[model samples]
Structures are given as C-alpha cells and as structure tokens.
Target: MSNLVEVKNLCVDYITFDGPIRAVTDVNFNIKKGEILGLAGESGCGKSTIAFSLMRLHRPPALISEGKIEFEGKNVLEMSDSELRKYRWQGASMVFQSAMNCLNPVKTIEYQFWDVFDAHDMVSNREESIKKAKELLRIVDIPEDRLFDYPHQFSGGMRQRVVIAMALALKPKLLIMDEPTTALDVVVQREILQKVYQLKEQFGFSILFITHDLSLMVEFCDRIGIMYSGQLVELAPAKEILQSPYHPYSDGLGNSFPTLIGDLQEMRGIPGTPLDLSKVPPGCRFAPRCHLAKETCHIKPPHIHQQNECRLVACHYPINTSDNRDQLPIKLTQVAEV
Candidate 1:
C-alpha cells in the first residue's frame, strides 16, 4: 500500500531559558493507507510532540526546527493558515489524550457535534447538521437521546466516545490518537478500542496510535515503531518487535511487560531517565544506560539496518543480549540473541 503520511528527519526543539532543548531528533517513519501504526515508548519520549508537528500545532518555545511532515507528499509545515483549516479535519483528525476534557461543559452534546461540522464548513443547515450528529452518535454506539445533555452529564468513557465520534464526522483519511484510552477504565478502554478497531476496518482509515502501553499496541497495531530519546530507534511488525526487538531501549521495554499466562511477575521499569536534550551528548544517547556500550557506541550514533521486511533497528550491539540478569538496570548487551 502507498504511504498516507511520511515524516522524514523530523526534529522538534524548545528554546528554554537555559538553552535549546531538543525534544525530537531525526525521526523518520511512514504510515501506509489503512494501516494501524503504533508509536510505543515511555512518557516524555516525544510521542506527543510528533503528533503536534504533524498537525502544525506546536506553540511558542516548541518549534519544528527541521525536517518534513508530508501528508500524501504535501509538506504540512508549509501549509497556509487557510490550508491548515482544511488540512486538520479533512485530511488528518486527532483524538487527543484526555480529549474529553476539551469538551465544553455548558454545551449540549448535540451542539458540540455541530461545531465540528461548522469548523469544517461541512453541513449545510441546522436541521441537516443535527441529523448528521444523530447518525454520528449512533456510529459510536452512543444513544441519540443523550445528545441534549451537557458534557458534564456523561461519564468519562461516554465523553471520550463523543470526542471520537466528532473526529470521525469528517471521515478523515488519517486518524492520530495520542493515548486515546488513557483516562478510561480498563474495560471501557477495551470497549472503546474494540469499537475503534471495528470502525477502522469498515471506514478504511489509517491510524497513528501512540501510547506507553506496549502490549496493547502489539494487539492493535499491524506495525510498530519504538521511540527512544526522541528518535525512532526501531520499526518492525508488531510480532517481530515483541519477539525480537533490536534497539536496547526496545529490548528494555519488552522486558518491562510480562505475559498474561506466565507466572505472576512484578513489572519493572527501564532504568535511567531519558537524556536532557539541551545537554545531549555527541554519541549514542542510550549508551549511558546500555549494557553493551563499546568505544563505537560512545563515538557515534548507529545507522538503521533493514534486517528483514519491516524490521529496522538503530543499534551498534543489537545482537548481544547477555546481561539480562543484571537487576534494576538490566543490561542485556551481553546476552546472546535467541
């Protein structure tokens, strides 16, 4: 399938009082038409920053210093204000993290649904818009009668469903969901995602799914990309990433989530905080915490190697997995690759 969105060498930076802090560095990836691609990493990993750049929504202090975010080969960063209005909803729509919080408390759900159409200049008249709103609510499995209630009247899950329904009203080509289920309870999260998965299958929309939940991503995403220190360190099929992660950061993440049927185990976190972008070193950013650090790792960053179809990794010592036993900061750089 052809690429629906392509981000090449994308870098986002923030000018702090201290200096320029690089948040995303040399990021590159593409989402194909009708595919679900997951961006998996811990918090503060620039996953959200990439989403903002794609929509050209970064505020002051945060800037897309370089690189291109191309939506169907058109540069998003170069779009005009009017162009952006058309770009946002018609081309790519986002279901943001805690999106329900952005809902207007006083506005009835029905009124808010019309606003989305109004912003895009879609519906022709009030009656037509309300009819459309009712249809959308039904599509999201929300009751049409609940449309007259205020946002505050709905539960978190219902509010989230409303937001997602609004995003789908325009039938956007690419849907960017940043931790879409973060606030919902586990069962609700599953229900909402199951609905989303079903909708994607029916409507044929590509999705950029971002979350720290690796296991969920594995189940939902056809392909997965692992981000580390603002860079995409690995991109592979979901099963490949889970079974044979390459980058040390990706490997560490795999270790953090245990299987459901396995012995009940305590979940562990990756040791060492991500690098401070302002003071980022010249060499591999993960070397400080990597167990397989070598003279080469400290001297320069590694290039991505395409080991197989849809499997690419940036790591100097990806094959070594010997140090898995090291506690807390488990360094698997020495462990033999299975």
Candidate 2:
C-alpha cells in the first residue's frame, strides 16, 4: 500500500509564560492506504498532540513549532484556511476522545448531519442531506428514524455511533480516532470497534488509531507505534511488538496489561513519572527509569535505528536481541518491582 499520510520531524510546543513546553519532538511516522496504524502511549505523552496537528486542528496555545505534515502529497502546514476547510472532512476526519459528548445538545441528529453535508457542499438541500444522513446511520447500525431525535434521546453508545457516521459522511481518505472508544463500556467498546473495522474494510480508508490501550491496539491495528516522552520509541507489526517488544518502555507497557493465554507474568508498571517536558533530560528521557540504563545511556540519546527488516527501535540497550534475549526476562522482572 502507498503512504497516505507522512509526518516528518514533527514538533509541537505549548506556549506558556514560564517557557515553551515541548509536547512533541522530532516525531516521524507514516500511515499507509487502507491500513490501520495505532499510536499507543500514556496521556500527556504527545499522542493527542500529534493527532490534532495532523489535521491542523491545534490552536495558538499549541503551535507546530517545526515539522512537515503531508497528506496524500500536499503539505498540511502550508494550506490556506479555505484549502484546509475543504480538506478537513473531505480528505481526513477525526473521531475525538469523548466524541459522544461532541454532539450539539440543541441540534437533532439529522440537523447535525445536515450541517456537515452543508459545510462541504455535499448536498444541495435538507432533503438530500437527510437522505445522506439516513444512509450513514444505517452504515453504523443506527436506526434511520432516530435521525430526528435530539442528542439527549440516544444512549451514549448510540451518540458515539452518530459521531462515527458523521465522520464517514465525507468518505475521507484518513480517519484519526483519538481514543474513540475510551468512554464506552467494554461491550460497547468491542461492538463499536468491530463496526469500525467493518467500515474500514468496506471504505478502504486508512486509520490512525490513538489510544493508551496497548492490548486493544494489538488486537485491532495492523502496525503499532509506541511513543514515550514525546518520541516514537518503537514501531513494528502488532504481532511482532506483542511477541518481542524491543524498547524497555514498550515491554513494560505490554506487561502492564493482563494476558489470558500466556504464562502468568507479573504486571510491571514503568518506574518514575513521565518526563517534565519543560526541562526534559539531556540524554535519554527514559534512562532514569530504565533498568538497563548505563552511563552512556544517561549521557547520549539513542537515535531510532532499524532493528531488522520489520522493526525499529530507539534504545541503546534494546531487548530481545540475540545477544541479550536470555537476560531480558530477568531484567524486566527486576524493573517491575521498582
């Protein structure tokens, strides 16, 4: 598949009286056509910042200080307001965190859909807009008759489905879902994700699935990128990441989730808090918490390097290598108690 979106040397900073806080630093990754790429990281680790920056939705307090965001060959950072407005829902759409509550309380479901269609000039009249809305509702398994009901009338799950339907109304090439199912219950989350997977299969639109749920990402995404302290520490196929995580942070994150089938491994929380962005460590941000950290690790940051044909990691002492695979489990166990 061809690359659908490319984020190169992306950096986002928050302007504050104290100083600029670097939220994202030199982040680089790409999403392919018709593929789902998951961005997994803890809150405040810059996952959401990257998602918002991709569509130029980030505002003044947050600025794209340095980077290039390219969607299907056009530079997103350079687009005019008019071009961006046209590109937004038509070329890309975002299903934000807490998206269920994003529905306007005053508008009926049908009217909201009409607003989307009208904004993009997709339909000429209310009748046509309603027709499109009904079709979209049907796609998400929502009853078409509910279109006239107000936002308060639908259940939380139903409201979320409505948002997903609206996002797809424009048939965008890229869909950015930032914790799309975070607010839903487990059953609802599964149902919604299943529906999303089916829709992706049908529409062939690529997805950037952002969430802190590594296990869920492992199950749903084709490839996964693990972010830490505003940098992508690891990137690989989901199965590969699950089987042999290279970065210590990635390994710790995987262990944090329960596994039903594997040997019962202790859930290990990554030690220490996330880096303070305002005064980020000089070398490796994770070295302070890494069990394998050496003097070199604390003095020199490691650049992202190809681990093999299918994986990449940014760690001087990566785990699961032929030389160190034997000691990985022991080191992980020791780190778990920290």
Candidate 3:
C-alpha cells in the first residue's frame, strides 16, 4: 500500500511561564492508504498531541518544536495558513474525542453540515448541501429527518454517529479519530467502529485511530504503535503485538487487557507512573519501570531496532527474547540511530 501520511522525528512541546514541557519526543510512524494505524498509550503519553500536531490543530501553549508531517507528499508543517485551510477537512479530517459534544446546541444538525460544506465550498446551494448531509447521515445509520433536529434531541451515541457523518462529508483521504468511542457504551462503541470500518471500505480512506484500549486496537487496527513517555517504543502488526509484544511496556499494556480465551484472572496494569517530561530522567524513559532494565539501559537510550521487515522495537532487553521459551528467536537489525 502507498503511504498516506508520514511523521518523522516529530516533537511537540507545551510552552509555559515556567518552561517547556516536552509532550512528544522523536516520534516516527506512518499510515498507509486504506490501512488503520492505531496509537495506544496511557493518558498524557502524547498520543493526542501527535494527533493534533498532524493536522496543525495544536493551539497556544502547545507547539511543534521539530518534525516533518507529510500528507500525500506535501509537507503539512510547512504549509501556509491559506494552504492549511484548504488542506484541513478536505485533505484530512479529525473526529476529536468528545466530538459528539462539539455540535452547536443552537444549530440544527442540517445547519452544521451546511456549515462544513460552506467552509469548503462543497455545495452550490442549500438544497444541494442538505442532500449531501442527508446522505452522510444515512451512511451512519441515522435517519435523514434528524438533520433538522437540534443536537440535544439525539442520544449520545446518535450524536457521535452524526459527528462521524460530518467528518466523512468531504471524503477525506485520511481520517484521524482521537478516542472517538471513549465515552460511548461498549455496544455503541462496537457499532460505531463497525460503521467506521464499513465507511473505510467504501471510501478507501486511511485511518489514524488513537485510544488507550490496546485490545480494541488489536481487533480493529492493522498495525499498532505503543507510545511511552512521549516516544514510540514499539511498532508492529497488531496480531504480533498482542501475541508476543517486544517492548516491556508493550507487554505490560497487552497484559493489562483481559483475554476472553485465557484464564480469566485479574488484569495487572503497568506499574509506576509515567515520567515527568519536564524533568525527564536520563537514558530510557521507561527504564525506571522496566523489570528487565540493566545498567546499560539506565545509561544509554535504546535505538529503534527492526526485528523484521514489519516490526520495530526500541528496548535494550525486550520481552519474549531467546532466553524466554514462549517466543521465537528475534533477529535485531538497526533501523535508525537514536
């Protein structure tokens, strides 16, 4: 598949009166055409920061310090305000966390869709815009008549579906869904994800799905990138990640989710809090919490090493190594210097 978006050495920081807090550090990943790439991590791990930076949506206090964000061969970070305006929504759209609540309380659903169409000059007349809006709503299993109803009239799930419809209005090439199902019930979340999968199949658009749900990501996404302390520690096929995680943090995250087929025991989450970015510890950010951490791990940062053509891991002593009998022998190849 062709690459839809490429993010390299991406770093983001929040400027405060005290100093700058590094939110994202030296992150690297890509989303392929018609592929769903999932970013999973705990809260404040910079998953959302990376999402916002991709679309140049980071407001004051948060700023892109260094990086390249390329979408379809165009450099997003270098685009002018005018270029950005044209690129956003039309090129790529973001379905933000709590997006269902983003609907204007006073405006009818139809008006909101019209506003999107108007902003992008997508329709010639109001009737045409409404027609497009109704089709979008229908795609999400919403009735066309609801377009005239206010935001409060719809249930939370229905409102979320409406937000998804709005995001798909332009048929963007890339869709960034930042915890789109965070607040929804399990049934509603599953329904929404199914709808999104169907839409992706129909539209052939790539997706960047961000959430803390590793199990959900394993089920829904083609590939998964595990983030820790503002950096991508592991990137690999979702099945491989779920079955045999390389990074200790990734293993911890995978274990944090309960398995349906395995012994239904209590889920043990990763111990220790995430490091403070402002006063980041030397060497590996995860070294302090890693059970397998060695003296070398505490003195030098591990470079991203390719385990195979499709997998990358940044860890001095990854889990499931040859010493462990459960996994296959992993051949490490240097991909990039840290």
Candidate 4:
C-alpha cells in the first residue's frame, strides 16, 4: 500500500529558561494507507509527543524543532489556520488519551457531536445532524436515547465509546488513537478495539495506535515501532517482532509480557529507569540498560539500518546475530504448529 503519512527527522522540544528540552528526536516513520501502525514503549517515551506533532496540537512550551510532517503529500506544518481547521476533523482526527477530558462536561452528548458539525460547517440542519449522531452512537454501541444526556451520566467505558464515535464523526482518512483504552477494563478494552478494527475494515482508514502494551499492540497493529528515550529503536511486522525481535530493547519489551500457552515465567522488564530528558547521555540512548552493549555502543551512536526488507533497527549489537538468530522464531513456530 502507499503511504498515508510520512514523518521525517521529527524532533519536538519543550522550551524553558535554560534551553529547549528535547522530548522526541530524530524520529522517522510512515503510516501506510489502511494500515494500523503502533508505537509502543514505557511511559514518557515521546509516543504522545509525536502524535501531538501530527495534529499541530503542541502548545507554547512544546514546539516542533526540526521535521517534516507530510500527510497525503501535503505539508502539515505549512497549512494555514483555515486549511487546518478543515483538515483536522475531515482529513484526520484524534481520540485523546482521556475520554472524560475529550468531552465537555457541561455539554450534552448531542451538543458534543453537533459542535463538530458547527466547527466545519458540516451540517446546518439540526434534525439531520441528530440522525447522523444516532448512527455514530450506534456504531460505538451507545444508545440513541442517551444522546441528550451529559457526559457524567455515562460510565467510563461509555464515555470512551462516545469519544470514539466523535473521532470517526468525520470519516477521517487517518485516525490517531493515543492510549484509547487505558482507562477501561480489559473486556471493554478488547470490545472497543474490536469495534475499531471492524470500523477500519468498513471505512478503510489508516490508524496510528499508540500504547505502552507491546502485547496488545502486537495483536492489534499491522506493524510495531518500539520507542526508547524519544527515539524509534525498532520497526517491523508485529508478528516478526514477537517471533524474533531485532533490538535488545525490543527483545526485553517482549519478555515483559507473558503468554497464555507458555509455562509461567518471571516478567523481565527492561532494566534501569528511562533516560532523563534534561541530561541525555551521548552515544546510544538505550546503551545504559541494554545488556548487549559493547564499548562502541557507549562511545558512538548506533546508526539506524535496515535489518531486512521489512525490518529496521538502531543497534550496534542486535539480538538477531548469526549465533543466536531465529531461536525465538523456531519456538514461536512450534507453538503455532501445536
């Protein structure tokens, strides 16, 4: 498939009296048309920062330092206010991390849906908008009778579904979902994601799914990009990463989650705390925590290279070496065969 969005050399910084604190640096990736591309990492790894940049939602403190955000061949950074106003909801939309935060507490659910129509001049007739609103609500499994109810009247899961309904209100070509199901129960989370995956197939829109759960992402997304200290350390097919990860950090992240079919084992999360943005170390950002790091890893930055036609990694000593290559792949293959 062709690319729907291309983000190249992206760097986002937060300005302070001292200097710009780089939150996300040198990130590059593309979301293919009708594909679900996921960004996975521990908290504060710049996944949200990159999402905000795509929407130009950064406030005064946060700024895009250097990058090109190209969406559908148009430069997002260069769009005028009017163009952006039209582009945002119609071309692309986002379901923010919190559903409660996304909805206005004082406004009725119908008004929340109508407000979007008002902003883009999508509809002037209230009855027609109401009809459309009911359809959207139904898609997310919300009752049409609840359309006039306030946000607080609904449960957390219902509110999240409402937000999902709003994000798809415009039939946007791309949808950015940032931690969309974090606040919900596991069953609700799975149900909502199933609804979204069904909607993706029905509407044919691409998705940028951001989350910390590598296991969940691997199941939901077409490809997974693992982030560390604001940098993209690895990108590969979801199953490939699960079967045999290339980066040490990616391997470590895979080990953090458990498998239902396997014998219970201790979850070995990546060792050490995340890097402090204010005082970032030189060379490879993940070198301090990576057990495979050699002398060169601490002295010079590892260059991002294509590990295969479909995989990319930024590591001096990737785990997929000749000596140990395909070890996990064979195990996973056997599991699948069983």
Best by TM-score: 2
TM-score for each model: 0.92, 0.96, 0.94, 0.95
The candidates, ranked best first by TM-score, are 2, 4, 3, 1
What's the residue-level lDDT of 62 in candidate 1? 97
Q: Give candidate 4 regions above 4 Å deviation.
A: 323-338
TM-score of 3: 0.94
Candidate 2 achieves a global lDDT of 0.88
Tens digit of per-residue lDDT, candidate 2, span 1-338: 78999999999999999989889999989999999999998888999999999889988899999989999899999999999998899899999888646899988998889888888899999999999999999999998999999998988888888899999999999989999988779899889999999999999999999999988887889999999989999999987777788998888887787766635566678888888888777789999998888998989999988989989899998889997686466333221210
- Candidate 2 stretches with Cα past 4 Å from truth are 330-338
Residue-level lDDT for 188 in candidate 2: 94
TM-score, predicted candidate 2 vs. hidden true structure? 0.96
Model 4: per-residue Cα lDDT over 2-27, one tens digit each: 99999999999999999999999899
lDDT of each: 0.84, 0.88, 0.87, 0.88
Error in Å for residue 175 of model 2: 0.5
Candidate RMSDs in Å, in order, are 4.0, 3.4, 4.9, 2.2
Q: Give, for candidate 1, the lowest lDDT window spanning 10 residues.
A: 329-338
Q: lDDT score, residue 183, model 2?
A: 70
